[model samples]
Target: MHKRAQVSVEYMAMVGLSLAAFFVIWLYVNSSNASIQQDLKVGFGKQVVTRLADAVNLVSVQGSPAKIFVEVNNPEGVVAASPSSNSSCSNVEIMLVMTAPDGKTTEVFSPVAANVSGDLSFLVGNPGLRRIQVEAVDFFGSPCVMLSG
Candidate 1:
């Protein structure tokens, strides 16, 4: 009887330890998934900002009014897009608001031009159909304006 009781206690202890280990693994996996999701959201924000900057630069260099479309995820909205004076050069700063899966909002800034000559008609809205219209203007001191389509 004493030997049988000892064996039963040992078995129960082993089962308890196994359950604890399983619980730890489950918690780790859940935390890892959450971390990966946050990283993906940050990466998406960076890609969108970089693409917007590239599009604006391309239009300015080509000296043509063009409509560029950008794809975005669950974006909160565009906060601001205007020409701002940096230390040495004037750049068009595009501020985009993005939301995470946890309902957290973040602002991403993309500088378009290092030296913007004229005004840029930057109109961006709707995450599904983001439209940006760049106006062709004279880079030199001469005044020039191009009509938008």
Candidate 2:
């Protein structure tokens, strides 16, 4: 009877240890996946900002009216786009706001340096198609506008 009881206790201890190890691994994978998702969002935001800045610079240098199309996959839509003064260079700030499945609104700000003139226009909505247009009204002004499709 003593030997049987000892063997039962050992089995239970082994089972408990296995469960604990599995739980730890599961938690680690979940956290890692979350981190990776966040990183991807930030990277996409940066790319959008860079592309917009490049478009603006191209129009400004060429001194003519131009149009460029941009596709954005923002869940919360685009909230704002404006020129912001920086100490080192001129920057355009693009803000993207996203809503989570749980109804939480999150905003991501991306800034890029470019010689932008005039105003910018963009619409906010679910992840989908979009367009950007650069128009030069005169020698002194160049505006970049985001059009809805």
Candidate 3:
């Protein structure tokens, strides 16, 4: 009877240890997955901003009355009030607001090389297919590029 009880106890101990080990591994994998997802979201946001900037630059270089249409995808977690107004052509930049798995929020900004400004309200905080209009215009006596949905 004593020998049988000893064997059973050892088996139970081994099983417990295996369970603990598997649990730990599972936790690590879950956390890593969340981190990867966060990075991908941020990357997608940057790509969107870059795409729009490219179109604006193209229109600006072409001069006034120049216009073009570009399609872009607005990633999730973008903020409506984001990308504050630009007072001058040099300060023009678009922003992407992102949220992480841990409930942390981040803002990513991409600058447009040429003078850029316009009503991007429809694009902010809205995730959908966006067809943006880019045009060169004369604003406040300065040449600039305008973006509209």
Candidate 4:
């Protein structure tokens, strides 16, 4: 009878250990998934920033009100027809935020149906050291890319 009891206790202990191991593995997997999601969010934001900066630089030529065009690209498969040239790249929404010398910021949204030209807000204060920031957000309202000059 003692031997039988010992065996029963051993079986219960083994089952408990198995359950503990399973829980640990589950917790690890959950943690990993959360980390990946956070990473994606950060990466998405960075990409949007970089692209915006590039677009601003491309359009902000010289020290004058030059008409500038923009192309937006969304790599997360969230936006259609990314890196679009001209107005042909439709349906995607974008926001252009420009900061002037007075530390004021202005925002413009798409349908930017026509090419725009103006003293970029960033250049208002300092012509040579003008700072320009453009941000394009996807349809989901997630930042696609932001460009700085």
Candidate 5:
């Protein structure tokens, strides 16, 4: 009877160890997954902003009334697309933000392009496929691109 009891205790100990190992691996996988997700979100944001800049520049050069509609895949999480806060085309920068796996948020200044104007509010925080209208317009007596959805 004592031998049988010893065997049962050993089995339980082994099961506990197995569970601990599984939990460690699960934590690692989840952390890695969060990092991967953040990277993909950044890539998606870059693609969307770049396309917006291209459309804006195209319409601006073609003159007023020129417009183009673009469809883009919007990623989940924090998202923002706006003209640089005085960020210039020569500088090639715009500002946005996202969270990291470590629960630390890194502030980023990186969404942008063209002498663009108008409301980019439509593109902010709306996930899934987004359709945006890029039109050429006059801003303060100068040629500018207007973004809308």
Candidate 6:
């Protein structure tokens, strides 16, 4: 009877150890996944912001009839907004408006998102404040830049 009790206790202890090991492994896996997700979010956000800033800065000082297009290029061809992976950005709109000193405003639609690479194009004509507004769900579908004359 004493031997049986000792063997049972040993078996229970072994089982407990195995469970603990599994719990530890699970914790590590969960933690790693969380870290990876955070990194991806940050990276995507930066890409969007950088592309916007770049496009804005590229044409801020230029006077023109300019047409610009922002492109999103990625190996997966999927540039999605936060929390969901949409193959393309559906909420993006870009408009170019030239406000004249005489209080005349001429607005034109700019290409918001295209799946391509290299310099983008925007059409704007005249010497004034040319406003370019780009709204998009993601920036990973193509290389983004503003090109104009």
TM-score versus the correct structure, for each prediction: 0.58, 0.60, 0.78, 0.40, 0.71, 0.39
Q: lDDT tens digits, residues 5-97, model 1? A: 999999999999999999999999999998787677556656666766676677666654444444444232433334422222244555556
- lDDT measured at residue 134 in model 3 versus the true structure, 0 to 100: 84
Which number leads on TM-score?
3
lDDT of 2 by residue, 1-149 (tens): 99999999999999999999999999999988876776675566556556666665565555544555555544333444453222222335545554443445556655533344333334444344445554433432433332222
Off by over 4 Å in 3: 1-7, 80-91, 101-104
Structure candidate 5, residue pairs in collision: 94-109, 94-110, 94-111, 95-109, 95-110, 95-111
lDDT of each: 0.53, 0.52, 0.78, 0.42, 0.67, 0.40
Question: Once model 4 is optimally superposed onto the true structure by TM-score, how far is the C-alpha of residue 27 displaced, in angstroms?
Answer: 2.0
Question: What would you estimate as the lDDT of candidate 4?
Answer: 0.42
Off by over 4 Å in 4: 1-5, 62-149
User: lDDT (0-100) at residue 77 of candidate 1?
Assistant: 43
* The candidate that achieves the highest lDDT relative to the unseen native structure: 3
Q: Give candidate 2 misplaced runs (Cα > 4 Å).
A: 1-5, 75-79, 83-125, 139-149
Report the lDDT tens digits of candidate 6 across residue range 12-35: 999999999999999999988866
Q: Residue 28: error of model 5 in Å?
A: 1.4
Please list the residue runs of candidate 5 whose C-alpha ends up more than 4 Å from where it truly belongs after superposition.
84-113
- Assess the local accuracy of residue 91 in candidate 6 as a C-alpha lDDT between 0 and 100: 25
Which pairs in model 2 have colliding backbones?
A: 77-125
lDDT of 4 by residue, 10-95 (tens): 99999999999999999999988866754553354345435554564454333233333444332221222122332232323434
Instruction: Compute the lDDT for candidate 3.
Output: 0.78
Ten contiguous residues with the weakest lDDT in model 1: 140-149
Cα lDDT, model 2, residue 105: 52
Model 1 gets an lDDT of 0.53
